[model samples]
Target: MSTLYTETHIGSMQLKNRFIRSATWENMATEDGHMTEKLYAIYKELAQGEVGLIITGYANIVAEEKPNAGMMGMYDDSFIEEYKQLTELVHRNGAQIAMQLAYGGTKTTYNVGERVIFAPSEVCERGTKTLGKAMTIAEIDYIVQAFAKASLRAKQSGFDGVEIHGAHSYLINQFLSPYYNQRDDQYGGSLENRLRFLVEIYTETRKLVGDDYPILVKLTACDFFEGGLTFAETRVICKKLAAIGVDAIIISGNIHGKANDMIGESFEGHTIQPQGYFHQYGDVISREVNIPVITVGGLTDIDAIETIAANTNIQYFALSRPLLSEPDLVKRWQNGDRAQALCETCSKCRTKRGNFCIVNKQRKATIAGF
Candidate 1:
């Protein structure tokens, strides 16, 4: 039997398989962050396509934190009913779904126009000259409360769990990375202080969601940049998060200018560019903690996945770009296809045009012309 098709558990959430549809920025939501028919169709397709667990794109925890147009929202109770419909739709199609909660911090605010961005310290954001003002203690408290409220909203929306988007230079990441955080206060300086923000969010969210609900975190194991978060720091952070009751940890890396490196570039078919790229760091973190570790990035081959599964403690494989090109990738592999994903990693999904597979679209157009 294929290990990828076997059942697994992330806390109390039972998944039919180990293939997780990692959060991808589906520019399908409305400007107000409400779900549209387009967004619903995408989730329904993934569920029907047999994605074991579908984690929705980052949902803003507050209005000011809205990063870009068409992003999902879960900041208030008003969003609960609409998302309930989404979760119910995915469930009907036989898949578990989770909502990723995030705050853009200094890295984003383009959608909200010129506004004072929040950060751990007043410094120019990397890759851009934009200055981030240090948030006051009151503002920090508000953000922590916002995360808790968002988690509660996710549970009320019938989501299986909530994944805190602590990676990718978001609010939580800025506070965790020494490259951005420079405060000498309780929220920064020491490693424990740098981790205080995320710990607080998890602690408060757990209090609201109770013990049975699975609370996951997507973390950066290495920033891959000078003066940024190191693997050593991330290992400690992962252990702390696991100790604090985080059900699982999704390991990912690179930030800001280095973000493209994490996604990787196009390659020849079946070559599997940098296959299992982040597995080593993930393995280290996994061994340091007792919680399940989900490894993502440059994973496209079934054989490679099986090898990694057999060799490491990683319990789940998360895919983003490959799924965009082929939502039924896991199902196809399980049916004995075993071929590598057809996605060339063109990254049209990351472009402003919208999140979609240009490769598939071009192929369809070419076939239609014939």
Candidate 2:
């Protein structure tokens, strides 16, 4: 068996393999953020496919602050019973699952102008062009408590871990981004101040979930924008997070005004970047931190994955679009069919009903024509 198939630990959570299904919005939840059968099937497929760890689509920690429609909610206890079923289902399939908690800041148009969108500073988001209200001290405390409560709910509902969504210019990431966070308060200004929000969230959540439970962070290694969070500063942040007892860090980056790092153009209206586009960022952070480091973004090739794993300190690899196109990709590779994933990075996965791979649909249609 390849090393990628071997067991490993992220904190106390044991993963069956090195491949993690990075959180991708399935957009299948009910309007009120309840789990639906469609959402259950999505997890069932991924867990049954033999991935090591599955990080769910980011769940809304604030009930009225869902920036995306059909998002899973953890704002209250109403989610506990249904999520228990979700966690149990994944466990039965021999996989561990983590629930990613997020509060979308200005990266939204979901309910723009209808409600307040909080941020570290009142800035116009480059990506969404939505202006966010500067979060008050009271509001900041409220969100910290919300994350803590949601993490407890995750533990009670049987999640193996909880990942703080601190990437993609979301609420937490906004606080980390210098371009977005222009406040002079204790929660903003210097890098240390900018980091206070996440630290508090982790501290509060740790108190509730205890020191033994895994608390992972999906961190923006760099903002990839002018006057934004830099990789040099991010290294410092990673070291601090490791020092603070975060079980693992998943390295990702955000490009202001852009959604992803895909380059070139494809016939399907989206292009794929070179495999492991974020590996450079993760490689450095892995060396900087003692805990496990996972890299997510444009990773699809098995040989490349193996080479990177062998050469770098990055402990894990995560995939999103590739798995959307081939849920059984990990199993396929392990079964000796190591062909790279078929996902073209078409960017057509999002739909009104849910996220479905357009390539898969076309392939099925072609087969039906025969």
Candidate 3:
């Protein structure tokens, strides 16, 4: 009988409510790949208001790939101390934090000039467009080790949990999507092989983290792009992850670059997007496994959330844009405030330069009830 405001547990971390701030890239990190004061302030604000859990923007596990396009990286040993500062800040304000670890696959980015892109396979026009050299088995093993090592670091950093980023056409997603993964040496070819990377990542991560620490995965039921991972394959992965003892699965869909295929859109849509916009996928996967299922997309309305909660099938909801515009949106909205924070979905938050503060002249300025 859980509702939006009810306290819940996903493995080790206890949440005040079911809401989580999904990972939204806000190029607010230190240039040297460490958490910055700007990033700390954002989480403190998110916690000061009403967020239950905060999943940070994608953290790079492979520094060579520049995983977050200059946002943040978790692959280094020194990052733990900076992350601890962030955890302490968020917790001091009363919010649990999780790190969403990511690795760029074919979309290897360059900070200023050109760079190399790696993937499970090298099939088509992507990355630098010159067809990346397909990764050997040895290279894939190295990636698994890297993910596991980073997870250990995240735990050491005082994070409540770590989420493997297996969605949105990143490295893990690339392996899942046949359009990019074309390897034949037992790392690609069949669906099982396609999932091997994620499975192995979870395996190695579980070995490092054990069952005490919460291990969640951010995955997509379908990539929603041409020749991308399908719902069929996604369901299989969900069940496998559940069988392997994953605490929860945060379901997301396709890359924002393909706006048309996107199930929904939001500039700050990473963490605060509503729950169950992808309920169809959650519905499919939840039916297949026992793990908690959380869905996120453009869930901007409060009334709609009430309806979602009434369903016994849903576990929780994640709201994105609303929290960005106003961190205390939950407190105000539930307290009978008709005028709510307005996030225009302007895509202002995604600019490589930095996230724009778009709440000044717009939101009608309701007093945040501390």
Candidate 4:
């Protein structure tokens, strides 16, 4: 029997099982960053589907720098009530939920020309091909406080935890990347300097949320390209986070600036991404740190998950695309079917209306004679 169905703890939070619903960009929120009913429906399904933990899509921390359209916002107190409803809904269904907070920085062009966007340095963002204004020390201080206040809001709104989005080539990841952070100041020269921004954010966030609340960080194990954040530097960052009292760490990363390449199998059917691509990093970091470690990177297959759990110190496995295709995947496994997930990892689930399984949709349509 697999041990994945057993209970686990991340700090004080007791989860029902080892399955975590990794955060994905739903693009289902309102333009102003409020959680919409669509998002609520999505979370509700996952909660009821028996996911032990759910990390909501990255909520934009600053109002002026929402890097993507339809992102949830946590810039002020206004977000509390709606989120309270969300947390209560998840809790009612017997699952724990955490809010993932982020600042998109130069990774997007959502409002690039109209407003000022922050970056570690004035490097051109490869994804959007846009430039950002290098932030001053005062601006950096403002953002640190923004993260702290957002954490407070998350706690007050009844979330079980908060995960800082320190990966995905976002603002924090940019600071940690030498390719992006060319600044010679205190925030940028060596690995220690590059780590300063994330450390400060964690310090301020911890102060507000208190020591008991679970504060997790999702970090890029490597930037997977030349001159970017390397795995060697990532190890040091994970160790520092553990020493400084982070409750848990989730290991993730980007490959050549393509998010899909990190997880999805080649759609052209020529190249295939190995399952659990990030597991090696998680295994190394988990052994090196004393805290809980969660790994996310196209993880599927019950047997493989069971094997990983049996052999490694990695405490949790997170899934995104598979869960999109089968929200009740955990329940399905629990019931003893134990087959691999139905998701093909084709990356077609992503759409403007929020991610839904295109394969499932087509199957249902065909069955209904549509």
Error of 3 at 279 (Å): 2.2
Given candidate 4, what's the lDDT at residue 99? 97
Q: Which residue window of length 10 is worst by lDDT in model 3? A: 266-275
- Model 2 ranges off by over 4 Å: 256-273, 362-370
How high a TM-score does candidate 3 get? Answer: 0.88
**What are the per-model C-alpha RMSD values against the true structure?**
4.3, 4.3, 4.7, 3.9
lDDT of 4 by residue, 205-301 (tens): 9999999999999998887767888888899999999999999999986753255454543321212236666777788899999999998876779
Ten-residue region with minimum lDDT total, candidate 4: 361-370
**Scored by CA lDDT, what does every candidate get?**
0.83, 0.86, 0.74, 0.87
Residue 140 CA displacement from its true place in model 3, Å: 0.9
For model 2, residues 169-204, the per-residue Cα lDDT tens digits are 899988988899999889888999999999999999
Instruction: Tell me model 2's lDDT, rounded to 2 decimals.
Output: 0.86
* Total clashing pairs in model 2: 0
Q: Looking at model 2, which ten-residue stretch has the lowest summed lDDT?
A: 361-370
The runs of at least 3 residues in candidate 4 whose Cα sits more than 4 Å from the true structure, single-residue gaps closed, are 256-273, 362-370
For model 4, the local distance difference test gives 0.87
Candidate 4 residue 344 C-alpha distance from true site, Å: 1.2
Return the candidate ranking by TM-score, descending: 2, 4, 1, 3
